[model samples]
Target: MQFENTLSFAKSLDLKDELSDYRSQFHFPKVNNKPVVYFTGNSLGLQPKRTKKFVDEIMADWGDLAVEGHFHASKPWWDYHERLAEPLSHIVGAKKEEVCVMNTLTVNLHLLMVSFYRPTSKRFKILCEEKAFPSDQYMLQSQVRHHGFEPSEALVEVAKRDGEHYWRTEDILAKIEEIGDKLALVLIGGVNYYNGQVFDMQTITRAGKAVGANVGWDLAHAAGNIELELHEWEVDFAAWCSYKYMNSGPGNASGIFVHERHLKNDKLQRFEGWWGTKKDTRFLMKPEFESTHTADSWQLSNPPVLSLAPYLASLEMFDEVGMEKLIKKQKLIVAYLEFVLREIDKETEGSFEIITPADRGCQLSVFLHGQGRKLFDYLMENGVITDWREPNVIRLAPAPFYCSFEDMYRFGQILKSGIER
Candidate 1:
């Protein structure tokens, strides 16, 4: 599709977009009495208009039914999280029984590591990309230390060459092979948060398993933004927050994936809780733990129903449109954004560079060579909502569900003006 850097062309694309109507479902922030051109769904997604309705239903149920709401309400508070499994599973390309909506991302990561990250004297090192999200870095460092291993020795980092912005896939696979018998776990973000590089999870998973290491992904940026086949990829486990591409509210509940191969493994060690007990006998208070034989077995407690409700609102949108359609539109919009940025680069004589890879999802991280926060501040002051990273990167993500091609074009104009000023 040939893209033109004109408002009419952008509007034409918007008119032809199949998912264009989805924008009306969300509430955008206002600036100068008009909706700002929002492009930060990679950080915190805009709230759906239906979110209030979902939350209100839960509130009303509790008000009228009280304790009986556990069993008598429309969704039944006792099994609220279960309602999200099928839809969430579809989003991540996993079996319904293999997915569960519970807990936050890091909490679920720690829980999954308890079962997958079993280190030994010989195979004690865990391999991951350098500069992973700070939370993941902290989690990996503390997990190894919990088992009395020094992080410096137990954590193996695969980094980019001297001045490169992203790690190459071949380099990552080579590191996996280099670590070989000593690599106990292969854990990395599915998409690099800083560079927006989507890793080849299938190849990485196959390589890790062949080398006798457990493989997992943190899909905070990949889950709803990209096409994931976690079960087919043979990933041991994965976790993601719903606040980003999933477009649930701020700090909402997260989704987890455990391949069917591990569901029936009674020998797998996990931090069990009563919520993980079989649903039929869960209320019996049995002394011995009996697993649910599904991914829910990792759930520590009954989920917070209020937080889970917004996801239900968002997942309904995902189920209706499906990932295939969403991804199709995502690629087109991102390509147009790249084109506009390149046009601006030509006008400015290479003032900034796009550091994100071609295989990325919605986000494009723009590195402003020498002009740092001044340009970023100009964008914000002019009502272009984007994210800024410390050294000199600005991140923009035009979410497929809500952002329009017109928004991208407008951003390009604002960016050009900011650069000129």
Candidate 2:
């Protein structure tokens, strides 16, 4: 479908959208006492309006019920963790038994590595992308060093093809074939954080398994922003933070997925904690660790319920919207932004370049030709809020749930002025 420059085209599309009303549910940040054109959801999501109410309910429970809130409340504090699992399962496209929300992203990554990254003499290498997130890189290196293997030698980074903006599927599959036998585990981001490239997790997982290596994903950017099938793809394990598109607030607790295949694999060793114990026998104070058979068995301690209250509210919205529907709208909204931005680029005769691929998610990574930082600063001054990535790139994400066609129009106008200035 093509959109004309005619104003009616944008208005018509907005009128036709079924999920349009959902935008009102969020608390959009303001600049100069007005709502700015926000395109930074890839970094921090706009807060759900209901998040306050969610937190308030729990706060009231804690204050009014005192120590009795654990069992005396309407939604018992004791089972609050269990209430989140069903809604969360739908977000990641997994069964209830396959996912658990606990811990921060990096900590959960380390926990998963402990169980999945068992290195042997011949098969003792970890394969990841060349420029993974700093957190993932640190965890992988530390894990390798712990096993008495040098990071440079034991950790293999499958580099991007020469002169290419992204990692090719065939190149990664070929590398998997070449190193499968010697590989201990494969951990890569479900989406590249900097470039916003959505990786082929299904293909990557299959390729890793063909070589007998366990596959895991860091879905920090991919979780609420993209549709995932962790269980269907047979990913051995995966982890994600909730602050980005999940709208769970800053430094929110994260989640993990473990395939049911590993449920009975007693050979797999996990870092044990009392929270991972079987529910029925957990408080018995038994010496032996009777680990739960599901993904919950990985939990190290009880989670902070106050931090999780927002996720419960946000995930409920996701359950109502459904991932398939959200993705359909996301593709349209992002494509529209690209179309407008590219049309502007064409008008300027290559004043800017969109470094991120057209196939990428809601984010558009743009490189300004000469005045990158100055232009970014000007946009902020003009009430267009975006994030600049170091020396060149500016990331703009037209989040489907809240950002409107008018917001995109306003951003385009501000961006054009910024480029000209």
Candidate 3:
């Protein structure tokens, strides 16, 4: 689709967008009596208008039903997390039984690693991409240390060449082969947080398996932002937070996927909890742990119903729009953003360089050569809500659900002004 760097053209595109009505479902932050051009959905998604209604229903149920709300609430607090499984499965491309909405991302990562990250004297090393999200880095480092191995020996990172901004797929695949049988786990982010580059999870998973390693992905950025086929890709396990592109709200419950192959594997070691026991006999208070042959077996405790209420509201929107339609708009909006950024670059004689690759989702990370934080502050003062990374990168993500083409055009104008001033 050809794009023009004009407000009229932006408005024309917005008029033709089928998903334009979705913008009303969210509440955008305001500045100077108008909604700011929000582009940080990659960090924290705008809250849905229906979130209040969903939470209120839970509150009312608790007020009237009290203890009985566990079984008698409108949605039934006892099995609230189960209601999200089907929709969450569709989003992550997994069987309904294979997906569970449970703990936060890092917590779930540790839980899954307990089962999948089995290290030994012969095959104890873990391979991952360089500069993974800090939380993941910490988790991997600590996990290896807990297993009585030095991180310098147990953790292997595949990095880009000296001058490059993103890792090449061939390089990553080669590293997996290089590590060979010594590699026990292959864990990496599906999308890099700094560069916004989506990894080739399918090829990476296949390569890791070929070398006898259990593969997993941190889908914090990839889950709602890109098309994922975790089950088809044969990924051993994966976890993601709902606060970002999933738009569930701040620090909301996360979703987990365990391939059906692992569901009934009784030999798999995990940190067992009472909530993971078979529901039928769960209340019977049996001392023996009978695992629920599904991803629900990973649950440590009953879910927080209030925290999940917003997620249910957001997942309903995901179900209504569907990922295919959302991705279509995603491409158009991101392409337009790219075009506008290029136009800005040309106008300013290449004032900034976009470090993000073509294989990214909604985000584009811009490296402002010599001009540092001042330009970022300028845009923020003028009401453009973009993300900034230290050194010299500004991250912009025009979420397809609510971000309009006009927002893109205005961002270009604001960016141009900031660059000039």
TM-score preference between candidates 1 and 2, better one: 1
Local lDDT at 52 for model 1: 97
Evaluated at residue 17, the lDDT of candidate 3 is 98
CA-RMSD of model 1:
0.7
- Which residues of candidate 1, in runs, are more than 4 Å off? none
Q: List model 2 lDDT by residue over 1-421, tens digit each.
A: 9865445677788888888898889987788898888888888888999999989988999899987887897667766778788988888989998889899999999999999999988999998998899999999999999988999989989888788768888888888888869988999998888888998899889989989999999999999888898889999999999988888999999999999999877778999899888888887989988868989999988767888899898998998988888788888888888888887787777888877775588888887888768899998888888998877888888888888777776777777777776
TM-score of every candidate relative to the true structure: 0.99, 0.97, 0.99
Clashing pairs in 2: none
Worst 10 residues of 3 by lDDT: 28-37
Q: Name the lDDT value of residue 23 in candidate 1.
A: 96
Candidate 3 residue-wise lDDT at 260: 96
Provide the RMSD of all predictions against the true structure, rounded to 1 decimal. Answer: 0.7, 1.3, 0.7
Candidate-wise lDDT, in order: 0.94, 0.86, 0.94
Candidate 2: RMSD over Cα atoms? 1.3
The 10-residue segment of model 2 with minimum total lDDT is 2-11
- Per-residue accuracy of model 1 over 1-421 as CA lDDT, tens digit each: 7879999999999999999998999999988888999989999999999999999999999999999999999999999999899998898989999999888999999999999999999999999999999999999999999999999999999999898888898998999899999999999999999989999999999999999999999999999999999999999999999999988889989899999999999999999999999999999999999999999999878889999999999999999999999999999999999999999899889999999988799999999988899999999998899999989999999999999999989998999998888
